[model samples]
Every structure is written in structure tokens, then in C-alpha cells.
Target: MEGSRRRTTAPRARPAATRPTREAGGTAAALPDAGSHGPPRGARSRRGELDGAPAETPRARAAPRRAPARPRDTQPPATDGARAAERPAVPEPQPPADPEAPAVARRPSSRRGGRSTARQPRAPRRSRRERDQLMDVLHALRLRRQETCVSANTVNTVVTRLLRGLGNRESEFEGVEQLNTGSYYEHVKISAPNEFDVMFKLEVPRIQLQEYYDSGAFYLVKFKRIPRGNPFGHFLEGEILSATKMLSKFRKIIKEEVKEIKDIDVTVEEEKPGSPAVTLLIRNPEEISVDIILALESKGSWPESTREGLPIQSWLGTKVRTNLRRDPFYLVPKNAKHGKGFQGQTWRLSFSHTEKYILNNHGTEKKCCESGGVKCCRKACLKLMKYLLERLKQEFQELDAFCSYHVKTAMLHMWTQNPQDSQWEFTNLSFCFDKFLMFFIECLRTEKLDHYFIPKFNLFSRELIDKKSKEFLLKKIEYERNNRFPIFDKF
Candidate 1:
């Protein structure tokens, strides 16, 4: 190994594709030192003779021109020199790791003194004065409507409240009082465990209602399940459905029941700004003239008539006919004061809905109810007539059928049974010895037959009627002689 020796030298540098930039001389280019000349400046004479080539300009040294960009599908010519170059020498740029920070601090356009305040919205706040103003308007409206709707019940309540002293309820509301409406949520509003919507409703306590009616101050009272709520609030969430439901029910009632109205004149109202109401006026064609219907079903005896005493209420026909019925459908009630209670409640008679007696005339075999001097009685016919008239006024065919046809069928069925048993109960039982016949005459077959009523043959009318074959009328009014009695009716 020591004996082998070799010398190596780098290959000669080739001309670059581009020319090098000339370095600037600090002062001036010196002429080559006298004996050390390399080659003439900017001349290629001696170096060019070694290669035997002519000298070229810098522009001529660049790579030869190539074709323009081709579509990728075309093949490019292979080159061994480029493929043999293993490593890429050029470097690519890199991105910064921290991108958020700004390269330079910026001076704000507006200075501290010129800055604007931030804005925000606030909740509404009404003052005491504003609240009082609103309440005043509402209170005034309520007070104005009260006078017209002054129910006897309410009037009585006012009177009672006055007598008992309303505690501090009389004081006017102060402006400083602040109420949070949301507090009701905590106050325990509840639907009653009871199915009824009301614990009790405001109602007239004393008077009872009749179908064909009479008018006067009346008071009502009853127990019901009322909702728990703040009485002060006009409408609360829990009560909204209640008020709506109540009005719906009332409208349904108007659609169903009620009869003719001969006259309606009312200035009174039940609510402020007047919502609809259940108002009825006395439009009855028949008016009750009798003070009472004398019915005696009581264990207690009827009061003996005394000249100096108060008139005894005498209803002769009505008696307690059934056991006490809890059902609402069976019959209406009469108070114990009506008559002393018997097995059931003793029935006391009222001329309340009765108008005048429905007197039917029958042919006289000298028969009569023996109500001397024509006892003018009041009856249900007037009520029925009034109801029919109201229906006619409203032009309601449905109501007309309900009252005149359906309701009357039920009532006629009721009244036709047992009837009043009027004679024996009212008069002495001994007085019924005279044939027990009610004299009925003049039955009208047509609604237009008011001008002419054909006579009905009662025992009395049978004798009075002389039915001859000719001309079909009585020749002379005949008489079955109970002729001994004075003919007071003849006049």
C-alpha cells in the first residue's frame, strides 16, 4: 500500500448558464503588475486557443428555448443528466407558528376622551301616580254601573256590611301601595276539590223563581264550591277559563228555554258595560189575582177564619202526594211555612204564577163548583200564554215547539192526572152532593173560533140544549128544574 501513490485534480469549471456580476473595485482598476500579466483584459486569445472555440457573449450562454406548457397527457422527453441529480438544493418558505399576535402595535384613531358610553335596556317602572290614575278610571266605571244593577241581594249586602262594619274595607286605595302581580303564583290558587266551580256565587237569598213570574226585591243564598283566587284582580290566568265558561253556559240557556214576552221594559243592568244577563220581566197575559191557592196537605189544621185576623192562606187541592224526592226532576219545592210538613212536605198553594181562573162552562143540571159569586182564580194558562208570546216575538220556531208542544205535553199530562180535586178539598165535602159535575160550555175547535164558541154539554147544558133535527139548534133554552134555587146566574 505504501508503494502505491496517486495524484488527483478537480475537473475544470465549465461556463455557467448565466454570467457572474462584476465586483466593484474600491478605487480604480490597476494595470496588472509589470511582469505578472495573466491575460489581456476582456480578451480570450490564449485560453480560447486551448479549446479551439470562438468567444461567446453572456446572453449566448443561457439554456436553449423550449416548447410552451403542454397538457399533462403528453409525454416529456427523458433526460439522464436531470435524473441522475439526486438531491434538490432549493428551499421553500415556512409559516409562522404564532399567527394571532399582530406584527406591529396600532395607535387607536379615537383617544380616551372621545370614547362613547355603552348602552343597555331597562324594565318598565310605573310610578304610583300612574297606577292611581288607571285604578281611578276602573273604579269610576264600576260605581256607575252599580246603581242600575242594584240587586236586592247586593243592596241587602251593602246594608248588612254597613251594619256589621266593613273593617278597613271602606278606606280608599293609596297610591304608594305596590303589588307584584306575580305574587299570585305563590298565593295558592286552586280548583276546588269539589267538582263545582264556585264555593258560592253571589245570588239573591230569599226569593224563589217562578216560570211566569212576579216582581219584587228578592234575596238569594246558596253554598257552592268557588275557586280560590285574589278577589281584587279582574282576571287571573286560572280564572280566565272560568269567566269564559260561565258566559258560554248562559248563552246556552238563552238558546233553550223561555217563552213569550208581551212587554219588556228594563233600565237596570247586572254588570258594568253590561254583559248579557238572565233578566225576565212580567209579560204574563194572565195575572194572579188570588192571594193564595188553598191547599191542605198538612198535619196541622188550616187556620179558622177570623174576622179580625190576617187572611188564612188556603190552598185546597194540593197535598203531599209523594215521598221526599232528592231528584231535581220530580217536582219543585214549597217551604215548610207553606204548610206544616206531613209525610212528605205538605204542599202549599201559591197564586204566584196563576193568572185568572180557567172557567169551563158545562150545561147545567143545576150543577156548579159552588164558588159563589164567581171565584176569579188565576192559573198556569197565563204563564203558558206569556211564554208563547215571547217565542212569537223572537220568531223562534224551536222555542215555539219546545214550550207549546213538548213542554205543554208534559204539563198537561201532569195536571190532567189527579187534577186539582178542587171542589171537595176547597168546599165542605158535604157540598159535593150535587152531582159532582163541573159545568163546561163553549169549546172552541179552531184557533180562529174566538168569535164563536160552540157550547159544551155539561149536565146543566144538556137540559138547556134542545137538540131538534130541524135547523140543528135548540128551539128554546130548556131547564132541568133545580128550579127551587134562585137563578142568580140568569142575570
Candidate 2:
């Protein structure tokens, strides 16, 4: 076994190329001779040999010498085709230029589709003193308008009498309650002090409401049981209550009544298509415009779609939200133009009464903003926002589609987020105003502002407001916010 192990462990001879050559000093060199031809067959070159083989011919020896090894930082730029091809194509580094030298403006790059633009520098924000002065001016303007405008008492008396007379003449409208709704009633009226919205709601019992669209705002109402001598019965096409027929009858009655009352100068405006209001121009010392809307007050359960919304639960408390939801909802004679056939006659649901209640009693605490209580800027902020929207609309005719209602809805949503009355302290009016403007800008950017009452209804409907107008309004809002609203300067 020992002899067999010795035979198997014997050392093999090294390749001729790998065998170390003895020099004059008996030093061993593993490399083959550089001047020699290719190594003999069956022999391999040593580790240090070029290409693991000796230079075979004169041409091989004369091959171009390799460039000297250079530090990465000091490497010369590639110039030759072969060197350039071997390396990545990179821009040549230019010498540093004078820092103070004027920049050379190159033509727009073709790669970028020739679009090269720079935004204009925004105007500096107004100083605190300037803003304060502006606020004073705004206040003075409000007072001046109120002073010059038609007397509210006279307007109210005239509208009330007219509505009463119409109700007396038409049994259907009898016992209809008059609700002063809109910006004027909400105490958010700005420039249009004379404009008033009075809704004459007729309570309709045993009515079934079906949504006209996915938006909870509009509905097709059906009378489950038409009461004897029911005034609304004639306006119904089958079981469905026709908004068009009801509004037409209401407008005709208002026109007839306006003619009989000679005491006050009142002229009914030409009816506009899709308008729910019977607009009357009253000249009682001064001209006052009143929009009398016909609404059906329905009591019972609120719509199922509204169950998840009215996030006021957090702000106004669960009890308050429950009470609000329990309140009867009103439906106005507002129809969509895009609605086809009978669907166009659908009435829009209105929570103006709810809104008024919420706005009037907006404080987290009951006495907030009331007499002998801490003053809050909730109404003041709403007024300012409404004024801004009105002024913008007047300035840019393209923004005619935008209304104060959008701003009002935004303010309501803003209140829910910051429910405490302290957040809207009178002292923080400027800050609150700025925050509201920011919210407006955000709504414009996203274009997804939900109706405060009906979350499903998008106040910023694409059909009503086009994309171009929205973009234009966004820029205008930013401009006004950055620069102290130049639009208000005229006032």
C-alpha cells in the first residue's frame, strides 16, 4: 500500500513556457523572451508574458506602443477615432469663465420642442399697514353701499306684500312660508345689497323623491297621494311634479300681481331659460332686485346619499348634526340644461334654511360672536370672500360662470375644518382671510369642490365652468393673493 501511494503522489514536469530560465546571476525569470517568436507547440507562456504569449514577428513587435498610464483626473481627452470610440462620448470641459460676465442666451433647444419661457416675478405682498388700510377702505365701501342702497325694510315690506297677494290669489301658494335666503340674508352680501333671495316654500306631504342624477342636489319628485284641490296637481305630468310647469305658473302669478300693485314701481324681468327665480326690479326710492323662488318643503327622512356627509358632526357636535339632518329639506325649481326630456324638469334640493341656521349659530359655543361674547370674523370672512368673487367676476367677463355660492360653500367647509370660534377671532381677520383665499385656490386647482350640504354635488361643474376659465381664475387668484388685490383698488 505504501509503494502504490508513492507512485500516485509523484510530481509531474512543468510546461516548457512556465519553466523558470536561469540568468547569469542564477536568478529565475518566469517570462518568455519578448523578441522570440510564438512559443513552441505544447508550451505555454509564463504569467508576465504579453497576451500570455511571446511576440511572434516584427509586425507584432512594431505594434503601436500603449499610451503611458495616467491618473484618472489627469487623463487626456480622447481625440482619435479609436480612443473616442473606446470611451463614452462626453462634452469637452471648457475653461472657467468670468463670473461677472453677461450670460449668453442661446436659442431654445430643439430637443425641448423650442419651448423656453421664464415666469414673471410676482409682485411683493402688501405691508401690514397697507393691508389694514385696505381693510378700512373695504369697510367704508360696505357702509357706503349700504347707505346708498334701497332700504331693506321697504324692500322686505314690498316683497312680503307681493308674495302674500300672489298666495291669496292662488290657493296652491296659500299658507306658503317666505324664507329670506342667499348672501343678503346670510349677512355676506357685498356690492349687491339690493339683490335679495326670498324662497316661498309650500309644504308637500306624502311625496316620494328620486334622484335625477348621481349628485344629491337635484331630484324628480312624485306625489304619492294628490290631495283634493291640490294646487300642484295641475303642474304634475302623471305622478311626477313638473318643475317647469310649477315655476311657469308661479312666475305668471307674480307678473299678474306686480301689475295690480301700483303703489310700488315693480317690473318683472324677462324670464331667462333655466332660471328658477322670478326676478323683479323694484323702484321704492331706489331700485332693488328680488328673486322670488318657488320651493317645495318636504318633511321626513333626509336622502340616503347625505348620510355620510355633513362632516359638521366634528365641528357642530353629533347632536347638532342630527338635529340639522332631522330638519325638512326644500326643493327649488332649478333644472339642469343637459337633462333630457322629463329629466330636465327635475327640481334642485336646497338646504338654504339649514345653511342660514348654521351660519347664524356658527360658534362652537352658543354665545360665540353674539352680544357680550368674544367677537369672531366668521361672517366678516364670508363677506370678504364673496366680495372678492364678485369683483373678480366683474373684472373678467370670462369668469361670469363663477358665483358667490362657490365661495360660500368653500367658507362653510373651511369652518368645519377649523370649528372653534377662536380660529376666526376678529383680531385674526387678515390671517383667516388669507387662509380662505388659499382654500379657494386649492379648490380651483383640484376642481373637485363638493357642495357643503350635498357631498356628491361638485360645485365646480365642468359644463358650467370650462377648464380654460378655471386656469385663468387660478392665475388671477394667485395674483390677487400675492399682490394686494388690485381689483378692489377701484372700489
Candidate 3:
């Protein structure tokens, strides 16, 4: 082994790049030094040397050249090597052991008092005060809105008496049961509870649905097997249920019952074209309106258009969605905008029940928004949006086509986009409300807000809202947004 060993002299000093650095933690860490790029300081350049020929040092080579003198107080401009030498070497950050863990922020260099020198951004001036004032205004508006809502006891008492009279007088309407629906029952009602949507649902046997319009919203209802002694036999026109005739008969029965209740001053309002509700104007103690919608409850499967919609797997859960879909859907006596041919035969599909359930139990977690659980500003955001729409409608009568339902649909879609409970934290009310408004404004700009249940159906289509009106509404909304919603001040 000694004979095979090659001659060896004093070992050359290990390069500074391989030297250990004493870190602030009192640990010697091996790090590549700044001078690793070239020969060590005071060493001659080996770039052109051959066979041990004499080489020139950097300072010796530059000694012949002279540069302009700067001010005495000004130091010489730093070279790349000098700058690198001054900067402490930092290792490339190692990723977290858990890939899903959030990344750690890199430490600021020690040169700038351990602070970032790239202009630390100052927080928005008066932002907290503005947000606080906005929330206070919203809370006041909500209280005022609550005051406008008609008393629940008063509504129940009047509806109970009216329905009882209808059941006793009309045998055909005996099976009709009340299904509370709409924004009022959903607990998002603003302005007044004087307006109520009560669906008079009549259970129907197995039925087939055919799309009446391309929108898949209006449908033609047909019974597979007409039951014997079906009171609706007269309301049928060539095997298809006549929504017009049935609704007219329903209106007549309700009108007769209203006359019987002389104690309460109630009068059926004149029927509006294309409206399915038989509106009742009550003027005994307060001026209140009740919209009695005639609906057909069907236990059959939902239409094919809804197959790709209701994306609630990541939000409300797939099992919850499936269970909700199993519940009966209603067919209101609502016809298309241009229902010239089949004016009285069309029925619009109503998912008011699903909407109510989703709103009432809206949360990713079971205890979310409940007592002792994390509260969210979802409902508050919705109310503010609704109130915004209401105020805008008052200013611009052209926005009559835009209703509270449009706002509700936008919010549901917003939930799917932002599913985290933390995003809707109640403490961040102003932030969440602004986010929701921006989403709604985007929908208005695109002129394409999809129906919650039917993806193919565009609620903001030209048929429902003209392009000119939408453009005008967009400007108004943007103006309100930029001005911190001055319209909300009216409330």
C-alpha cells in the first residue's frame, strides 16, 4: 500500500466556498462564500498563465487607467464582488415538509433595520372608520326594514280564516294546502312584510312535463293517467292541463270567500296579464297584499335541464342536494312572455321550497351561523343587496324587470365560488358585502346570469331585460360602488 501511494505534499487550503460560517445561532453552517466565482483575494489571475509564467493581479492591471474623482464625502461605487461580499448569504428556502402547508415568508435582509426596503404599503386611510359607519347604517336599515314587515301573527290569523272559508265553501278546492314561499318566508324580506307569496299547492298524480319554451322554465303539464272524479277534468284542454282556466276558477272561489269574511276588509285585485297570483288587497287596519299563487305539486323527477345544475357538492354536500331534490316541486300557473298560442296551457317550474331550505340552512358546517358557532355575514350581505336593488328601482323605473330574485340568484352563485366560512366572517361585513356587489355587477356587465336550477336558462337575457336597460343599470351600480353606496343612505 505504501509503494502504490502517489507522492503527496502539504494539502492545499480548502477553498473559502467550502469553509463553515458561524451563524447567529452559534452553529457552524457550511455555505458557499461570495468569492467562489474567482480566485481568492490577493491571489494572481490564472486565466492566461502558462507553465508557471508570471500572472498579473486585478489591482496591478487597473493601475494604468485613471477615472474622474468624485466628492470626498462620496464613497466609491460598489462593484458586484464588493456588494456580494457585503450581503450575507441566504440559503434557498426549503419547502415545507407537508406540501399543503402554507409557505413561510422570507426574512427581510439585515441592511434595512430588518425591514423590507421595497416601500411598505400603508393601510387605507379612514378605511376602518368607513367600514364601521357602513355597518352601523346597515344595522339601522335592517331594524327599519323589520318594522315595515307585517306582524307574523296578523298574517297567520287572516290567512287561516280566509283558507278555512275557502275549504268549506268550495269542495273542489278542499285539497288545496298552503305552502309558504318567497323572500318573505326565506327571512330575507326587506321594506315590508305586507307583500306575501303563499302558494296554494294541490297534489297532482303522476304527470309528464314537456318544455314549453327553450328556456326550460315554462312547461306543459300532462297527466299520464287521469284519476276518476278529478275536479280538474273540466280544466283540461285535450289531455293537457289548462293553467288559465284552473287559475280563473281558483280566483273566483277565493273572491267569493273574501266577500264572506265581512269582518276583514279584503278585496281581490284586478288580475295582471301573465301573472299567476290572485292578489288580495286588505285594508282593515293596514294596507297589506297577499299573492295567492295557484300551484300543482308533482312528485315526479325534475326536468332534464336541471341535470347539470345545482353544483352543491363542495358547498351544501352531495347528500344534502340529493335529499332536497327528492322533495316535491311545484308548477305555478305562469306562462311565457309571448304565450300567444298556448297562453293558458303553460306552467312555470317553481323551486321556492329548495330556495327556502338552502337559505334557512345555509352553511358549510352544521353549526355555522348558529349559537356558539362561527357566524357569517351571508344573510346580511343578501339583505344589503336587496335593499340596494330596491332603492335603485325607485330611482330608475326602467329597472322594473330587475327583481329581488335576481339578487338572490347572484348570492347563491357567489356561495359556490367562495365556499369557505372564513371568507364570510361576520366581523368582515363590509368586505363580504362589497365582494358580493362586485360579483353582481360582473353578472350585469356580462348580461348572462344563469338560473340557479337550470344552467341553460339565462335570467338576464334580452327577453327579460333589454341591453340598454342593463347597460344603464351597470353604470348606476358602478356609480354607487365608487361612491360607497350613497343610495343606501336613503334608508
TM-score for each of the candidates:
0.15, 0.72, 0.72
Q: Please state every model's RMSD to the true fold in angstroms.
A: 52.0, 27.2, 19.7
1-491: candidate 2 lDDT, tens digit per residue: 01101111112232223322311111111111111223211122222222112332322222233433321112223343334344433322222322321121122122111111134343333245544755774585474555434467767777778767966774567767888888777766666467888888889878898887576778889988887887677888888888998888888888887888777888899987788899989886667888888889988798876766677765678798888898898888898657342355689888899888888889887888778888777888787777777778877898988887887787777776666665565644554565566556556755657777677677776856777888788788767765677776767
Clashing pairs in 3: 149-193
lDDT tens string, model 3, 1-491? 11111111212233334322211111111111111222212212223331123333333222222432322112123343344454445432211122211111122233221111224322122145546766776666553544454455566666787678877764667878889998778878766666788888889878999897576898888988887987778989998998898889989988877777766677899999889999988774777788989889998788887776776766788898899888888899998777344467889989998999999888887888889998778898898888888889998998988988899988887776555565566655654565565556557756778888887788988877898888777778756765667786677
Task: In model 1, state the lDDT of residue 65.
Answer: 38
Please list the C-alpha lDDT of all candidates, in the order they appear: 0.20, 0.64, 0.66
Q: Which stretches of candidate 2 lie above 4 Å from their native place?
A: 1-126, 143-150, 227-229, 339-343
Error of 1 at 291 (Å): 28
TM-score of model 2 vs. true structure? 0.72
The digit string of per-residue lDDT tens for model 1 on 293-363 reads 11111122111211111111111121211211111111112221212321112111221112112123110
**Ranking under TM-score, best-scoring first?**
3, 2, 1
Each candidate: how many clashes? 41, 0, 1
User: Which 10-residue span in candidate 3 carries the lowest summed lDDT?
Assistant: 1-10
TM-score of candidate 1 on Cα atoms, chains taken together: 0.15
User: Cα lDDT of model 1 overall?
Assistant: 0.20
